[model samples]
Target: MSPESLRGWVKRDRIDRGEGGPGELTSAEREELTRLRRQNAEQRKTIEILKKAAAFFARDSDR
Candidate 1:
C-alpha cells in the first residue's frame, strides 16, 4: 500500500489507542511524527498532480 494509506492506518490506530502507537511517543517523537505526516501529505498531493498530468498527456498523445 501507499505511504499515505499506511499513515492513515497508523493515525487511526493511534487514536484508538488513545495516543501514540504500539509504543508511546515522547514529545520529540510526536513532533517528528507531525512533521512526517505533513511531508506525507505534500508527497501524496504531488503524486496526484503528477498522475493527472500523465493522464492528460497520454490522452493528448492519442489524438
Candidate 2:
C-alpha cells in the first residue's frame, strides 16, 4: 500500500482504539453513520415519490 494510505489506516486505528484523541469516531460509529445516511437518502426519495403520486391522483380525481 502507499505510505499515505497506510498512515491513514494507522491513524484511524489509533482513533478507534481511543489512543489518538477525544471526539473522534470509532470504526463502528463511522459504519453506522454511513448506513444511516444511506437510509435517510432512501427515505427522502420515497417521500418524494409519494408526494408526486398524491399530486397525480389529486388532479385525476378533479377531472
Per TM-score, the best of the predicted structures is 2
What is the alpha-carbon lDDT of model 1 when measured against the actual structure? 0.85
Question: Candidate 2: misplaced stretches above 4 Å?
Answer: 1-6
- Model 2, 1-63: lDDT tens digits are 899999999999998888877778999988999999999999999999999999999999999
The number of clashing residue pairs in each candidate reads: 0, 0
TM-score of 1: 0.63
TM-score of 2: 0.76
Model 1: pairs clashing at backbone N, Cα or C within 3 Å = none
Q: What is the lDDT of residue 62 in candidate 2?
A: 100
Global lDDT scores for all candidate models: 0.85, 0.94
**Model 1 alpha-carbon drift over 4 Å, by segment:** 1-22
